[model samples]
Target: MAKIVKPLSDQQLLRYSRHIMLPNMDIDGQEKLWNSKVLIIGVGGLGCAVAQYLACSGIGKLTLVDDDKVDKTNLQRQVLHTENNVGLNKCDSAKQSLQQLNSEITIDTHTIRLTGEVLLQTIQEHDVVVDCSDNLTTRNELNLLCFKTKTPLVSGAAIRMEGQVATFTMDKDQPCYQCISSMFGEQELTCSESGILSPVVGVIGSLQATETIKLLVQIGEVLSSRLLMFDAVTMSFNEFKLNQNLTCSVCSK
Candidate 1:
């Protein structure tokens, strides 16, 4: 007496054939990705790439959050929003674009600033929370909430010619994002202030997507307790270990 394993449909098998053929991915990994739900905050540049890749990869569901409307200036880096999508809410614009990419996946958009109980419940609902957010306040808030819900977090940020990505498994023994931000003294900066290269975000956001897929499929070594930095100026990458801050408020006693 053996358990039954439902096979992927012809359409799914065809759609995800590339993934199913991978040595590590195969059918089981593709199935796990199909069953995973990922929450992405900030449907801007990073969000655009993250959601697009996740959707096309066959993730079961994706929830996007963003209160801001698309501005003409966003076209430079936020590649998802076209001239026609200008003035549309980012979440709406992103959903429309992502829907065009993959119809099998469910895409939910929250066209409002995510905060309070709503934020808590949203994170709790998803398996992974991706922070493509620009501001430090939101990132810190997400880190704390993700910790509370014991959900894994994949965080990314791009400003000027530099970008960074990190992950927190929300394990009690692991170092959370606040552990690293506190080390930087929480300096707040936006793309408008510092300016970002058009492709720089794509590079980082693609990495974020890569990290998310690895998290979902439980493949390879995750970036937990580590930060990856990329400098477009030098065209090089660097990595650093993030240790829990002993005196810090979050992820520490």
Candidate 2:
């Protein structure tokens, strides 16, 4: 006889009943979610949403990495934090919120800055890596690390009224984040200067969580070679095709 998969316990069934009811995310998908592990590189605006959704969605383990502390300004787009969390490390606040959101899943917090060697060590432990960082420098570093480790990376960014998301796989054909950055250059605005809408970040971050889940469950088509761009002001969505740059320092490796 084929191996029998255990059914979810009553409490777990109750907690994820809605997801269990969906054909796409039935018990099997939920089981896959429950067994998958994801590493989120930042606990800011995008990380806040990505972590919350992934934890609540039944991911088995999460490793959060961030070096910043909460401040009054982060309240605008960093919903996982609050006024009380000011001066506290973002990882601490995120852990508090995630534990409250779902105590069933385990969270591992890293309160240190991510650098070359450190980044590689962390990516090796998780099944997928989510880049919720805000700067191009750290973003490129993470892309290189993920590619070198042969890990799937779900990269998302939001600023002003626009946001973009893409999944980079280390299959040699997919356009990595470094490739995209080289083509577009780092001409985008930052929230510190240009500002961002809270909901815009929320929308993009939530999609990052969705993409992470899809990649973890091995369900649906992963956004491996396409960029999903959203413009909230016009409420328009566009997908631009992306190819692995032959000269890409990261992807070409």
Candidate 3:
């Protein structure tokens, strides 16, 4: 069943006036965003940035999943958490921040790590899924689930001074994360070990948020079938075409 979009109130029009004034995103596009639901995995650096922007932009519903707690180390890049939130569950802490940004939007928090059937069910409920998780395992799982369900996914990753963002719509000709990951073999680097630049995640995360909005509003060219890479050291942005793998273990079926 298709969800019916409610008429925007005067307050909503005023709140989103800037967006409504944009030629690409007028009232109709803003309404589409107001009726959309997005699930964000991992409330880390990338997740925090993505949630913050979406919340302010008025995404109807946001589900934040993360089992980890806020640590002192996260303060540098995870802007959604503060020193006072240290030791608190990341999801709860993020909820507090997002609510402060936009109390009108509904925010759901999940404190436990998502896996198995539970994860699949959660992904099935949302209009779009944003992958902010760090591990290849979790990324692969999300890609497979999103592919099976035909949900659009905005994926981002950052390590050291490099970052990348991609969108997977599970289109027949589009490649899933597994297809891209397979080309590079197994990933062994992590932000904790490699030390990511604070702004790198922000850059990639912001792009993921932009892609999610574009997908929901049905406007502009999304990152689908393409990968956008950023190098903070050299301050350069590059894009690469992503090809579907017919024998991809996750999306072939």
Give the residue spans of candidate 3 off by over 4 A.
none
Pick out the ten consecutive residues of candidate 1 with the lowest summed lDDT: 1-10
Instruction: Pull out the clashing pairs in model 3.
Output: none
Query: Model 1, range 1-253, lDDT digits (tens) per residue?
Result: 7633445688999999999999999999998888888999999889988888899999988999999999999999887899999999999998888888988888988988989898999998899999999888898999999989999999999989999999899887789988887756556777888888989899989999999999989999999989999999999999998888887688776
Judged by lDDT against the true structure, how good is candidate 1? 0.90
The digit string of per-residue lDDT tens for model 3 on 1-253 reads: 8768777889999999999999989999999999989999999999999999999998999999999999999999999999999999999999999999999999998999999899999999999999999888898899888988999999999999999999999988789998888877564797788898898889988999999999999999998889999998899999999888889998777
Identify the superior model by lDDT, candidate 1 or candidate 3.
3
Could you give me the TM-score of model 1 versus the true structure? 0.95
Q: What is the C-alpha lDDT of each candidate?
A: 0.90, 0.89, 0.93
Error in Å for residue 41 of model 2: 0.9
TM-score, model 2 to reference: 0.94
Segments in model 1 whose C-alpha atoms lie over 4 Å from true places: 1-7
Give one digit per residue, the lDDT tens place, for model 2 in 1-51: 763344567788789989889888888888878777899999999999999
Off by over 4 Å in 2: 1-8, 186-188
On TM-score, the candidate that comes out on top is 3
